[model samples]
Target: MKAILYLPLCMVLMSLNLAGQYAIDAAGSYVKNGAYSAAYSVGEVSTLTVRGVHSTYVSTSGVIQPDPLSITGTKNPGIATIRIYPNPVNDFLRLETDRTDLIQYVIYSMQGSFLAQGTVRGMSVQLDYLTPGMYLIKFSLVDFHESQSFLISKL
Candidate 1:
């Protein structure tokens, strides 16, 4: 008798949980569709307005969570498209690009000290002089106004 009653109670609780999952999924879809405001909290401690693409959260304790996308920022990834290989390079580092003309490169230490600067000679630039560590490479195309930064490793 008890086992039969227990089975129905368990089924009821499981069904409610499954329905809640569907409701949350639908709410997430609505959030992706348009800007909408929603808040949830345990008791009256904190109320967060996590709404749309630019949504954020805040608590009564004054803690806050900014929109994730804004935190990282954004960049064009322009010349970073070019292949730079033998990374952790021992000697020369190559900058392979279709338009090599008028290209200028400046290498800087991880600490922002100017290490090397020059035009692209062929496809590769010499890093034979640099001590093994990390460096930043800034590449610029004179007329094109195109620039990109690359974090490189040396060995």
Candidate 2:
């Protein structure tokens, strides 16, 4: 009789021990299956599952709600090779790329207003007149486009 009760108690304890927390970096994603015991990563999408635990879903545009019993992480779906330097620039901004071919770059205000546009062959852009504020920097390949928002402050 006591042995049967002990078995049940042990199972409960084991379940509690399995519960853990996980975070997904991607914007729009979801997790399914027990305590997230299974995991898969393909390109920009990631899927995880744990036995007997709740599933989690994270999306690029969605809120991040992590499961306490299961741990998971995700990478961004769309990432570019372009890089920006002096992120918090005061006067001049530099955008660099590895590609030797012509690249199109655009700068926009946080409000989505176009601030500057030009072509570059050396993989770098120098912005010397833009004011200090939050702005969006967009780099475009032949068909793919990636944009990141950054802040600028005068030193």
Candidate 3:
């Protein structure tokens, strides 16, 4: 009985000694918490970059600045002359533009996945097939590089 109990106690002690903790220590820059670990460098350049459909943002140094991505009733240069109505639309969505040369359009989901594409017919496109969600429609000219993207919703 004593031998069996002694062996079991020794196994438990050994197991406790084997409990996990990070083994790698490099220049003493490692930090560890319960089940979490991280290593840090002393001198490293970090930057933040954000890209949008209409603009781009970058931060080289850590400084708080006004949000450059907010939409404040201003128009994007590419789509300044373009307009769409019935934003949260049902059945059909209408397009209004000064230029009648708009020839093609592509529909994309909010996650940037292409869902549909077709030539522009008349002044509207039938969106009755799309499930209710947010989408983006890109319109392009027939013989020009001018293209515009508009965000719309399906209801």
Clashes of each: 0, 21, 0
Lowest summed lDDT across 10 adjacent residues in model 2 is found at: 37-46
Q: Which stretches of candidate 2 lie over 4 Å from their true place?
A: 1-80, 143-155
- In candidate 3, the residue pairs with backbone N, CA or C atoms under 3 Å apart (3 or more residues apart, or in different chains) clash, namely none
In candidate 1, which residue pairs get closer than 3 Å at backbone N, Cα or C atoms, i.e. clash? none
lDDT of 3 by residue, 70-140 (tens): 33475445433668888999989888887767568899999999999998788888999999999999988
If the candidates were sorted by their TM-score against the true structure, best first, what order would they fall in? 3, 1, 2
Query: lDDT of each prediction vs. the true structure?
Result: 0.69, 0.60, 0.75
Q: For model 1, how does the per-residue alpha-carbon lDDT over 1-155 read when each residue is reduced to its tens digit?
A: 99999999999988883533111111121112123333322233444466677776664322222232222454554443466887889898887776645778999998999987998777888888888899999888877777878999989
Q: Write the per-residue lDDT of candidate 2 for residues 80-129, one digit (tens) a residue.
A: 55666786776556666555445676777878888888765455566667
Candidate 1 root-mean-square deviation in Å? 14.5
TM-score-wise, the better of 2 and 3 is 3
lDDT score for residue 18 of model 2 = 71
lDDT of 1 at 58: 60
